[model samples]
Target: MADVTPNVSLVATPEAVSFLQNCQLPVQLNAMTGNPAHYDYDAEINTAITNLQGKAKESATLVARLTQDEVRTSPLKHQEASKLAGRLVELAEGTQRLLTSKAKGYMDASSDFMGKTFTPNPQREGYYLRAADWISREAKNGEGNGYKAIREAVTEDPDFAVAIYNTSHRLLGLPKEHAMDFAEKAVKAFAPAALDYIEKSQRLDELAKRYPAFIAQVRSSYFSPFELAKVRTYVEMPS
Candidate 1:
């Protein structure tokens, strides 16, 4: 009889191990199993990754151009940047809808727990609706007028968290470092209300994870690189 050979397990390379750690477990496992039919799957994955990177770069370029244009414009010239920011807001709204649709598509595509667990749910719809309504009201007043409306709203109702948050976001376009102070004030004003919504949504299983990170990101997004540079200039100038 021919001598039987012992089976030796293959070890993952350092690079492969690092990649696996970064990826979701199912994807990592699929790559490791190395079924012949899936052997070249990395090519498709790499292509997708490259495409995503290119898209992100393009978006970043657009945002930078918009910011530069805003900086160069006078207060009287705010119309141009206002229009661009409005367009961006519209794009963000559309992207959110698209994401929801895609999630539904994924739920429909899968079977068993994969499908069941990802089924459509309406837990945070109310919170989103409230936020959207607030944003819409502010948008109706026009871009340059956001700060005024926010101030009026806050004056009428000092406890209005959403209005305070909107004020912070509006100030992001301003050249003065005072915008940072406003942003901090907004965070303080909105934290309680925002946390209440977060807790309620979490209790309802709407926000499954990363709730704190989500809130933090929203708060921080008020200041971009261009805005920070402007703020710094304002700070350095003598009164």
Candidate 2:
């Protein structure tokens, strides 16, 4: 457990907020609005793969243009080529990571035309595979764990937490009884490390430890399509 994480205990919401504030992590109640559809994992992966393909083609063209002869002929071009080469190397690495044997299977199974949404196989889907797809299609090029990337993303933008819940609920269409099994598993599997990033709240960490199921419910209501839209407005309005 992090030194900052509270014990596996909580009081009422109001009390929890006060307790956290006393601990120096002030709890600010702010509202935001969002579109749930924006968080669908399948759609996110589809768009990423499409973009990767376009970049792969563009990289290949650049590679063709920056031939050895061209570099040898122009001293000025060598410096430009060096910078371009660095970028192409990054692109190549990302492409390689995304198209590995296992990742390629997911990519092949999940591809879609531009502007079309992709859907997961309901019966076959599991959070592990979803994490794998996320790692391949969306994690930073070198990041190995999709959930860690997801955790960072969620912490960076709480909206991502809503997306996880919404996608699991709507796109995957798992039974309500089991819909948030992933969140529960996340609580147990990742535990303290995961909570450390969530709003930097000892109270929330304790809440997750004590009531993982409730966390999903809270996120569901708090980030509902209607509520998320409001939050988006709040976020976008001028400071």
User: What TM-score goes with each of the models?
Assistant: 0.23, 0.20
lDDT of 1 by residue, 71-124 (tens): 442331223323433443344344334334433433444323222322323664
Pairs clashing within candidate 1: none
Model 1, residue 169: distance off in Å is 51
Per-model C-alpha lDDT, please? 0.35, 0.34
Question: Per-prediction RMSD in angstroms?
Answer: 27.4, 27.6
Model 1's lDDT to the true fold? Answer: 0.35
* lDDT tens digits by residue: candidate 2, 14-68: 4432322322211221101112133234454334434533442353333234333
Which residue runs does candidate 1 get wrong by more than 4 Å? Answer: 1-73, 111-239
Evaluated with TM-score, which candidate comes out highest? 1
Off by over 4 Å in 2: 1-41, 68-79, 91-239
